[model samples]
Structure formats: structure tokens, C-alpha cells
Target chain A: MTNETETEQTPEHVPMMQQILDNPFLLLFLGVTIPTVLYILWGVMEVASIPLAD
Target chain B: MTAETVVGVGRRAAAADFRTCPYTGLKVDAAAQTLIKANAVAAVVFLLIGGLMGLLVALTRWPAVHLLPADWFYLVLTGHGANVLLFWIIFFEIAVLYFASAVLLNCRLPAPKFAWLGFALMVVGAIITNVVVLQGESSVMFTSYPPMMAKPNFYLGLILFAVGALIGCAIFFATLAIAKQERTYEGSIPLVTFGALTAAIIAVFTIASGAIILIPTWLWSLGLIGEIDPLMYKVVWWAMGHSSQQINVSAHVSIWYMVGALLLGAKPLSEKVSRTAFFLYILFLQLASAHHLLAEPGLTASWKIVNTSYMMYLAVLGSMIHGLTVPGSIEAAQRKNGYDKGVFEWLRKAPWGNPAFAGMFLSLVMFGFIGGISGVVLGTEQLNVLMHNTIYVPGHFHGTVVTGTTLAFMAGTYLVLPLIFQREIVWPKLAKIQPYLFGIGAAGISLFMMGAGTLGVARRHWDITFSDAELSFAHSAGAFLMMGLNGVFAILAALGGAIYVLVVVGTVLFGKKITAGHKLTFPLHAGGGAAVSQYGSHATTKLPGTIVLVAIFFVCFVLYYFINWKYLSELWLFR
Candidate 1:
């Protein structure tokens, strides 16, 4: 029963790349800003990228 | 009683003033007990303040019902971190240092006046810091990284507190030397005292680092100095910041063994092994501070990789050794008492009703499983980016510092009230349940916050929802659920903390007094010196039940470790 539960929890054969792209931020970082420093607050998009109150 | 009386007399004659605990057979100095009481009372007051601030912070993080305004939330967060992390824990540690040296070794406290001076400075500093934070405008969180500055008084308050703690450490060392000259215990010092000594040494290093960074920053805040480099500030500051928690680790691990000895008549499975682990902590543990700077740009990849990978694992090894031997010792003792049926019959029969045992055992398990495993994960260079500056960071520390250290300290206090204060515990039923309530609730808060952080919620943001931001980001349904649940558990933990405060305060003020030489009718088991052995002649050495538990822990650790690696790998296509 324990072995079966372990097997069930482990991811079965979905492509790892597909899993990575599920988070939109990672996809944006890899596709657009791979060479640049990926600082969201330093002006990629207009407005405060970070929720930090100045 | 008088200063002249204590000063002129030979050290052996000073023993005339000491009274022996009838239960534990350890001599207690009256001055040490008074200092312990004062520090403990102060520690609980700060816990109440910090715990209330924590509840408000938790509620504000809950997206569906954000409680505090952004300004108020930041202010409270600053107060919460300072009081709980710095003031509460350090005050209690000074008390522990005195107890381990003077009381356990059965000697007079050298320079009682210096101890009182340290206590007065600490009390004044804690009050000043709190007052300045509440006065509004110093919302720079615990890491008051300048470019952003708090009031000059905020910096001054911290410096004063550190100097006071340094004095306490000096007194602890002097007492140890006096104990040696006076010939208190034979062979080496007790393992608990050795652990405390390790903490004191680390604290001195930590306090010096703080003084180096904070003094210049204080001048900058006063506009007497020009510029404070942010990177330079962070590098020096975490030497104190991270090592402060390391102090907690040593002290609480000592208490783990103490509670075990008190409750189960346990001994360290091997005193040499246990002492060696503490030695490793002294040598390599503070190197783990480099993990805080891993994602910073100023440091090189080689520096980060070496510090986080090789040297950091040595520190990890020290903790892992402690994790195994502490419970293993208890299991070995129980088996000797003839509970050696199945793998866990000894564990099953162990005293669940004793609040001290229950709190310490729960602290050990939660710390190992939640704090230890998560700490190793977050320290990894590649994996840290995913959780860095997220609620996961707070989640991880609350596991270590709150559930682990604070819970263990609370457990130690249960023994202290009866043992030192000569007072019976008030509301015995509430005291018994307090650990479970706090531990379980704290565990929930940790797990749920980590869950939210995994789903990419920000830390230190007043609102997780991006409600005030121009670009509003929507978090996953799971993140919302996790945060809402975190709020619920925070309330539960606060209730548990309230029970502790009420019980401790009521008992200290008005409970029935047990005269120091008499036996108690409460939770602490009535056991003499044989019951509190750190080593033994009995050789029934197998700890199969503890071995099984250790195996289960390793399984959980391995699975969680790999899962984080997989998460990191997904963040980059090549790496």
C-alpha cells in the first residue's frame, strides 16, 4: 500500500518542459530576458513590478 | 548576602549560601534564580507582543480578508520581527547561560552586579526599540538595510542590547572559570553546559559582527557619516542575523537532552559523539550564513557554491547527528526499563502527560522534519531563487525558531518554575495541552505559508494580491487557499501562546509556593542524580524503535530534497 501511494504521488511521464511553462513568469524569463538580468522591479513592464511600497 | 561578604570569603565557603534542589540534586544559587526569573518574565512579555503582531500580519496576508492597512502592516511586521527574533530569544538565552554555568556546576555567580547591570541595559534597550518602532517612521524591517534608515534611536537600542548580551556572555565564561578553580564537577563539564558555552562563543562573534555594521549605520542615520554601502551592510549584518538563530539551535538542542534526561532518565547515546557535533557547530555552522547572500550580485559563483555546498553540509551533518542521538538516547533508556516489546512499544509507553517531555519531543520532531529539511533545501544555490524573499523564508524560520527553539524554551520553563522559582504550576490541564496546541498550530502556519510561497506569493508585501499595483497579477487558487488557512492557524497558535502567558504569569504572581528543599506534586518527575545521567554503565545498546523513526525521517527528507531540485530544474531549460 505504501509503495502504491508513492508511485501515485510521483509524476508519470508528462514532459518536463511543459511543466516548466505552466508558470507564465518562467516562460517570460526564458523566452524574453534570458541574457538580461531578470529584475521585475527594474522596469520590464510599466508600473511597479514588485508589490513593495516605496 | 552583602558584596563584601561574598568577595572576601574563599570560594568553598560561598557554597554555604547555595541550596540543593531535592528533586534533581543540583545546587541552585539564589542570585542565579533571581536573574532567571527576571529574564524569563521579560521574555514572556515580548512573546505576547510578538505573537499579537504575528496574528495581525497573518490576517493581512489572507487575501479574502486583509485585516491591517499597508502602513500599519509594515510597522507591526517590524515590531514583530524585532521582539520575537531578537529580544525574546536573547533574553531567555542569557538566563540559560547563567543556569547552565552557576546552578548546574554548583558555584556562586561571579559579579552578580554585572549581571544586574546587563539585565537593566537589556530591559532599557528593548523598551527603547519598541517605543521608536511604535512612534512611526522606522518601518525598515529586521534587516534594517540602510539607504533606507530607521531612527537613530532604533540603531542605538540594538547596540545597547548587544553590549548587554556580551556582558552576560562574559559573566557566563567567568562563572565557568570560577567553577573550574572551585572544582564543581569532575571530568569535563556537563554536555548541556558545553552546548551553552558553544552558544556563548557564537554569540560573542555574532555581537561583534553586529557592532561592526550597526555602529557606522547609526552614524549614517544621524547624518554624521556619508554613505552606507548596501552590499557591505548585508555581508556583515547576516554574520549576526543568521548566527543569532544558530545560538538558538545550540541552546534548544541542549534543552532537548535536558528534557530527555529529566523525563526518561536518558543519557546521550555517546557523549563523545554528541560533544563532537557541538564542536562541528562551533567550527562550521556560521558558514551557513552565506546562503542569505547566494542570490546577491556582489558575490562570486565560486564563493556561493563552496559555502553553500561543501562547508554548509558539514554544519548540516552536525545537526543530523544531534537529531538521531537525542531520541535514540530516550529509546535506549526506555528499553532498559523493560518496554522492549515491538519497535515502538517504548515510545508508546512514554509520558505524554508531562508537559515538559511533550513540548520538547514535539519540538524535536517538528524541527527535524519541518525546519531541518526545509533549511537544507532553501540553502541550495539553484533552488533558493524559487523561494527567496517569499513567504517560504518566514515559513522556514518559524519552523526552526518558533516551533523548535521557542517551544523547547517554553518546555524548559515548565521545569524551571517548579525547580528554581519553588512554585507549583497553575492551571495544570491548560499547561499540558499548551504545547500540542502551539506546536500543531505553528506546524500548520509553516506548511501553509510554504505552500503559498511555492505557488509564487511574495514575502514582505503588505498584500499578496497586487491589489494596489498597476500590473495586477493573479495567484493560483491554491495560494489563496493556503494563505487563508495560514490565517486560521496563526489564530490557533496565538491562543496557545495566550494560555502559556496566563499560566506562567498567574503562577509566578499567586500560585502555591513549594519550599526549595521539598518535593513537588506536579508534572516534573521526582528523580535524583541517577535519573539525570549523561552517560551510563548499562549496555542494552540497541535502539531499534528510534532507528525506525530515523529511517522514516530520512525518507521524508530525501523525497522533499529531490522535489525541490526538480522545481529548480523546471525554472531553467539548461542547467
Candidate 2:
């Protein structure tokens, strides 16, 4: 069978994304990245995250 | 010719019987071959030089041995660092650029003359800077931190080299544009080309940042401008330096995909997934560069925290996604095709015996597990103090740069050599062993040095201790042991490099000359049609003596390090 049909048929698997809610490895990676992401998000939410001062 | 004749001519030209195998697209004119050969030679020379420098640094850090003289130590260190890290890897990238655009995409480089000009300028620039550093005119490390100045020529050479690289990138994009306008490929670019194109795009931005910083710095050096801001220059420099590094990372990852596809016939697990990973690099790589400045005094707490923590996390996510996708694709391919039923079926069924496949595999594993882990930890804000400018930094990069990027390039060379040169390798056995020796050695050294760095070992020094401070004898002993082990690895790598040189040289000079139409086959295999499928087509009979000479020059570079060490030992001894 051609690659196109196989790709179309295969179901999506978001194992990491799913596991991020629970799995230790996933959580550890997420725990580190999430806080940083949120911190950046917090600043961006206030204004653009540029310049030294708020 | 009539319009009909013109159409017919176009079709025939398109269908021209080039002797390159279907996989590698190595078929090209002598002129193109000359350009590619020149780039490859420069790349290999830089790779060996870089790898040797890496080994020396590792030796000093790992076993805490003072392998060279105290006075000239930092100068050699900086030269070694810049030559190998920036020069070697990027030269290979240029070679890759030539291959991807001209050969792989089946399009002539839009301006071959400009490309040659770029290459010439880079060579001249690199040589000047390298020579200046060797003479102890400057030892600013690879970063070339200003305030701690070098000769004016050093900065000028750096700017010229970067400008030349910019021209090469411009050529790459122009070629791509022409290919698109001319409708070179049937549909979307083949996966490899697509990946390379992404790398090229990243390179455009990366080089721009480099130029922005380096050009200003050069002017400042000449006193053409007064008072350049060191902080601002550093920030901008990282924009280039970090992004250029990302280009390597992105290209290496793409090569992982290619290696998987070509060697194991593995398809990307999810095409969209892989593409997304490449895209994430474009988004996150530049931002992540801020992590390099985490421990610096001037940067605000908020700035450092956000850049190191937040930006780095996103970068890590991109890397993690890729870490999953590359192997996933290979696994999916192996499983889908019904390879074997062992517990570790994928591993068991994999063509582990094939040097190209094995080398690619080891490179991927090393980069992902070792390099990836170190990257995350070092990028963390608190962890930066422990690792920054320490032996760990070099250790971490060696895992990625030498073992990861260089190994993939070597594997690609092995697969493409016959198609490019139309000659069988002189020593396939030794050729296969080279990557393993190099990769294992690199990993050992990186691991050992990282351990040393954790114990607070400084980098770019002839001694482990700070002046007037008592040294940790136990830590120093561990560092020495690692360095001694690294020396062994270096010797192995050199041996592997020797075999590669011999193979290329023998193939070019004395191997039985075969014509373009000759069917290529692996000596050991016959009926499987697998080996033949990969290499049998696109054989061309051509004298590659010049190419072989270029290869020899690179080999000699590795030899030079050892010879230099012999003399350098008289000045300073590890013992």
C-alpha cells in the first residue's frame, strides 16, 4: 500500500501530551518547562516581555 | 530548434542518463564535483581539527591533567575551540548546502561563481584568524569576548568569514527559489530537501545576527566607532552564535531522518510531526540563546529567569518532540514492515552491522540521551553557575557537535562516496569501525568531563585550581583519569580517520576504474537487492585524484595535532 493511505488510516497518538498529566518523566519535563512557560506568559500577559522594567 | 524540438530537448535533458544512484543524487558535472570536493575537504580538515581540540580539552578536564603549557594554554584552547566548533561544523554545513540545493534538488546553483567567491573569502578569513591565534596574538576563546581584545586582523577575518557564509546562504536560497520557479521536483520537496530548506531559512536569520554583531565589533576594533556596548554586542552575538548552533542541531536532526530513511528504509513516523519539530526550531532556537547569559551579573533577575527558564523550556520541548519523532518514525517503519518478533525487535532487526546505519544510530542516541540531558540542566538558571565556562560546557557540546553532527556527516559520506567518486571504498571494514570508535570515545570523554565540571572544574585553563587556592586533589585525580581515557579515544578516532583517508585515496588513485553505467554492489551482499537498490545506479567513471588530495589534506590535519603535541610536550607536560 502507498504511504498516503497508511497515513490517512493511522490514528493519532499523543502519548507524551497525555502522559504529561501524570507520568513521572512527562511530569518532570513538564514541571520544568511549564513554570518557565507560565512565567513568560505572565509577563507577556502584562505587556510585551521586552525591556528590563515592567 | 523549433518549439517542439525545444520541448523534446527539455525532456531529454531532464531524462539525461546521469550515473548517480537514485538515493543520494551524487551525479554532477566536474565543476560541481570540484566545488563539492573543495567544501568537503575543508569540512573534514575542520572536523579533525575540531575533534582534536575537543580531545585535548576533554583530557585536561577529565583527568585534570595539564596537557600543555600554562602561558599558551588559553590561546590554543580558544583557537581549537573556534576552529573546530565554528569552522569545521559550518564548513560541512556549506558542503551540505551545495549537495542539498544543487545535487539533491537536481538544480544548478543559481550563481556558482558567487558561491565560489563565498568559499574563497571564508577560507582566507579562517586561515588568517587561525594563524593569528596560533601565534598568540589573541586568545579570547571562541566567543572572542571584547574588552579582552585580539589583533585587528582577527576580528576582520571573523567578519569576512561570516560575510562569506552569508553569501553562501544567499546562494542556497536563490537556488531554492529558482528550483521552485523552474518546477524542479514533481510535488513537495522530498523529505531530505524539505529539512535542508528549513535549515537554510534558519541559517539566513542566524547569519544576519552574526553579521549585525561581528561587523559592528570589527568597526569597533579598528576604532572606526567609539564605545561599543559589550552587553548589547554579546546579546546580538548570541543571536547569531546560538542560532547558528541551532542550524547545526536542526540539520543534524534532519540528517537523522535521512539516515533512518536511507540506511534502514525507515519513513518518518509522522511527517507532520517531524515537520512541526523543524518549525519549532525556527520559533524557539533564537529565544533559547539567552540561557547562555544566565549567570552574568548585568542581566536582571527577571530577564535571566525568563530567558533561561521559560525560553529554554520551550526549546527543550522542541528537542523532546524531535527526540520522540525520529525514533518513533524508525520504529513505526520497522514494525510496519514486519522485521522481527524479538523483545527488542527493532534493535534486533535493525541493520546494525551496516556502518552507515550503526553510525547514524549511535549519533542519534548520543545526541538525544547525553546531549539532550546536559542541554536541559545547563540551560536551567541555578545550574548555569555550576556548568557555565566549565569543562561541562565543552563536554556537552562534544556529545552533540562531534559525535552527533560529525557522525551523521561521515555516514552520509560513506553512502554517497561511490556515487560521487565512482570508486569502491579501499577499506570498508575499517570505515565501518571509525564512527563507533569516535562516538564511544566522545561519549566517554563528555561523560567524564561533565562529572569533573560538576565538581567545579574550570575550562580553558592549564591547571584545575584557581591561583592561591587549594585544589581538590581527588577531583583533580578523577579529571586526569578522564583525560587519559579521552587520549585513548582520540587515538582511536585518528586511526579511523586514517582508514577513511586511505579508502578515499586508494579509490581515487588505484582502484579499478569503472564507468558511470557500472552497477554498484556491496562486496558481501548479492541477492537481497537492498544494497544494489541504494548504490547500484549512477556509477560514473571519473578521475577523482584532486578530490582524494583534498581528503588527504584533512587526514594530515589530524596527524598534525599529534605531531604538534610532541613538540608542545617539551614546553609543558601532562605528567
Candidate 3:
């Protein structure tokens, strides 16, 4: 039974190389740039200043 | 699919040898496998002991209910808290160190013998300490705050363990040096390895402080030295304790990123943002330890104000930044899925059913809301008088440490186990359930504990309200709530923990072998592929990105220390 299930769900070895190439900008913005900016903001900001602002 | 089915699929793709890589000297040897297995086993044993100790302490405080004999209760509580929080966690940290340095770095350990020696020393120290405490001779609380001394062995045992840990840290550094000299990889260290390296840096400072404080305490215990200044020792001790806590925090944040990436096929919300947060921790975490001593005497008002108001603000900002980035990464991942639009669309469409993801998410939220809030409040010099040394402090940490950090580690372990060990987990079903049960139970305990803490309930005691019975009826109500909730939570968490233990045990011992080269399938949202390009272009460039970040942090460190030094000179010396 286990063998049947194993054979049934063989993982597709889809190389992400092409997708990465297609949308390079979106990838860069989400993965690298944003985190970098956030880090700068965090270093500068004072915690007591952030209002609940709800 | 069941373990059997997974194994079958893996068998077809299995590399000729699962234990070794021909190209790289990474992966465990058959003998090394035994050591790694032993480390994991020891970690779980300590976890159970710690959990039980927590239970005793929690039960005793719940409405002042004394389950154990009053005489022996405090002793058990102290041992339990120290062993669980420090010993168990450090043991796990060593396991993580091994994984990051060797397994993740794709290199063999430089000195396996020293690594084993470190483990042995730590174990011997822990055993001696536990034995002494259980014999009812050493009742000093977790901090074993001097002036209230424990038996000689207890302090000696602690110092030995810390020394062993220092050796372990040394081995980690040695391993990294070898990797660099050998040019283990063409480009930068992997992100997980980078995070672990940062943690190792923090541990260096942490253990140095520990040696300074503990060695002196050891001498004092043996009558070999005159009185160590209690106030100075307090300051130095917290330098170790609090900074060590930050190491856990930084490590957990890294694990959070890993868990999200591995489980959900998510990219960091932003690599730069996450890396920046990691750097901020190195800058701000050490200074913030002074917040713990706000209510203590002999510190000038200006010192307390600067430490509490300025430094804690930076630390809080670091946490808040992470608070935003962690969720933002998840949201970006969900957005990639193109889920239906709603106010809570991201929350609704999230893979809530995946225990690993859910557990990680909840842990982050609880840490931010409960732990972070309590931390800010308690760190206030004025507020410290109300909450210092109270149940609230422990509650805050439990929320952060147990929920935020340990849960993430456990979740990551479940995901990584099959890949690391090359053995199928014994009970996949139980593995899935364990995180939620433990997280929920822990969160419940934290909530009750915080409530009690707000009432100025003292921690590190069997019965909270001493003599005068300053606790109001409402306070008593909160205590009962804490006790009852924690009791239920403890059982649930233990049950879940037991299942995890069984799964780990079975995998190491009785579980069937799996074929090598088995790749775990991570579901990709549309944006998942985007991260590959992002990381490849920015982070994967050949200049050692992590080392560059560390260097940048050191520059900031110099500036920070210079400023603090000037301030200290003016306040203490010139004044």
C-alpha cells in the first residue's frame, strides 16, 4: 500500500531557472531590496515613537 | 503518502551512498551519525526534564497551591528552571551549531574529537548539578543569585558546563576557519550558516561574561576568594544571561526564515530587510541587558535612563522590524498564490493546516504581542519596580522563548529530519500535531503568567505571596487561572513532546532506512521562483555577503561602544 502511494506522488523536478529569468525585477524587489531598506528603517526608528494609531 | 511510500520513492532516486558525498566531505559518517543521534536524544531528555520543572514551578504559583513539600519544592524549582532553560537549550544550540557548521556548510567538522569532549563536559556538569539539587542541598533559584548561595558542586558544575560550551564555540570557529581556508564553497556562506555564525559571535561575548561571573562565584563558594561585589556581579551576570537570551532570539529569527522558506516555499519578505534586522540585533541586544537591572540599587539615574530609554528603544525597534518583515514575507508568499481579496485575505489563504507553518506563524505573533509588549513595559525603570523579578518576567520569556523560538526549532527539526538523518520519521501524523499542541499550551501558560506578573507576583518562589498576603482576590483569581491553564497546557505539551520524542527515537533506532537523494517537495506559489533570481543576483555574489554584513556590524559596534564609554566615563569617573 505504501509503495503504491509512493509511486503515485513522484515529485516533479521542475527547475526554477526559467521562471527566475522571466521576472527578475519582482524577484529582486521581494527578495533583496525590501529587506535591506527595512533593516535601515529599523536601525533608525525609535520604538516609543510608533503610535498604536488604531 | 505513508513513510513506506515516501521511502519507496526515495529509494529510486537514492544516491549510491546516503551517508557521504563524493564531491564534498559533508554529511555524517556512520560513527558521526551515532554522535549526532546521541546529541538529539540528550536534547529531548533535557527538554522533558525542563518541561517537568516548569510544571512544578507553575503549579506551585497557581493560587499559591503547594503540590510538593514546601521544604524541597524551591530546590526542585530552581534546578528545573536552570536545567531546562539553560542546559536543554544550549544542548540544542550545539546540535544546531553542528548542523550549520558541518551539515549546512557542506564540510566535515575540523575537530570531531574536541566536539565530543565539549559534549561530555557539558553532560557531566549538568548531571552533577541535577543530582545535587535533587538531593535538596542546592535550592538557589535559576540565577542562583548570590548572597543566597547553593552547595559548592552546583556552582562548580555550572562553571564547568559554561567552560564546555566555550570549547564548543571554539570548535565552531575552528570549523568555520577551515571551511574558509579550504574555500569550501565558491561564493558566500548559505543564509542559514550566516545566521548561525552570527549566533556564534554573540555566544562568544555571552560565554566570556559567564566565565567572569561564574568563576568568581565558584571561588566565593569554595572560600578561596573574598566577597565578590554583589552589584557588580549582578551587572556582569546579566551581561551573560541577557545576551545569551538574545542569541536565542537571533537564532529563532533565522529559523523562522528557514521554516517559512522550506515549508511554504517562501522567500524572505526581503533578504536585505532580514539581514539588516540580524545586524541590528548585534548592535542593540547587548546594551538592552541593562533593562533587567533597572530596579537594582547603586546605578545612577542617568545610567538607568540611558539604558532603559535609549538602548531598549533600539532593541524594541529591532524586534518590531522583524515583526513586520516576518509576516510581510508570508504575505508576499500568499500574494503570489493569488488568493481571493478580503481584509484578512493573507491570513485566510495561508497554509494554516500545515502544522509547521502554523506553529511558526503563531509563535511569531505571540512573541510580538505578548512577549514584546511585556518586555517594553517591564524594561521601563519606573515600571520595573512593579514587575521586576515577578511571574510576568518568566511569562514574557516563555511566550518569546518557548513559543517564538523553541517551537520554530521543533518545527524546523520535523521538516529537516528526513533530509538530515536519511530515515523516515516514525509517525508523520504525530509530528504534524506536536507543534500546535505545544505552542497553544505554552501560549496559554504565558497568558496566565503575564496576568499574575501584572499583579506583582514574585517569581522563583514556591508560594508567591509572602506573609502579608498583599495579593488581592483578583490577584488570586489570576493565579488560579494561571495554575489551571498551565496545568492543562503542560499535559498537552508533554503529550505532544512525547510523540516528537517517539518520532525522533524511532527514526534513529527502529525506523526503516530511506534511499538517498530524496528531495522534499516544497509547494511553490507564483512568487516563489522570483526569490531564486533575487537571492542569486544580490546575495550570491562572490564577496562573502555574511562576512561583509558582520564587518559592517563591527563598525557600528565600535561607534556604539565609544559612545557608551564616553557616557560611562562622564557618569562614573568624572562625576
Taken over the whole model, the C-alpha lDDT of each candidate is 0.80, 0.62, 0.63
Error of 1 at B248 (Å): 0.2
lDDT of 1 at B429: 92
True contacts kept of 1: 0.00
B1-575 in candidate 1: lDDT tens per residue? 00010112235836546777777777778888888889888899998998899999999998878999999999999999999999999999998898887876777888888999998888888899999999989999999987899999999999999999999988998887777677664445566777787788778767877898899999999999999877767777887898889889999998998888777777778766777787667766766777888788656666666666786788789899999899888898788777889989989988887788889999999999999999999889989998998899999999999899999999998888888788888898999999999999899999998898888888888887787789988888999999999999998899888999998998899878987455554544444244443233223458788888899999999999999988888887873
TM-score of 1: 0.88
Best by DockQ: 2
Worst 10 residues of 3 chain B by lDDT: B1-10
Supply candidate 3's per-residue lDDT for B336.
Answer: 54
For residues B441-480, could you state the per-residue lDDT of candidate 2 as single tens digits?
7677677667666556666656654444565343456655
Each prediction's TM-score versus the true structure: 0.88, 0.77, 0.76
Q: Candidate 2: which stretches are off by over 4 Å?
A: A1-54, B1-32, B56-65, B335-338, B465-480, B483-575
B83-146: candidate 3 lDDT, tens digit per residue: 7677877777777766666554444566677878888988988888888888876887777777
lDDT of 1 at A33: 31
Where model 3 places Cα greater than 4 Å from the true spot, the runs are: A1-54, B1-36, B337-350, B464-479, B517-575
Please give the range of 10 consecutive residues that has the lowest summed lDDT in model 2 chain B: B1-10
Candidate No. with top lDDT: 1
C-alpha positional error of residue B500 in candidate 1 after TM-score superposition, expressed in Å: 0.7
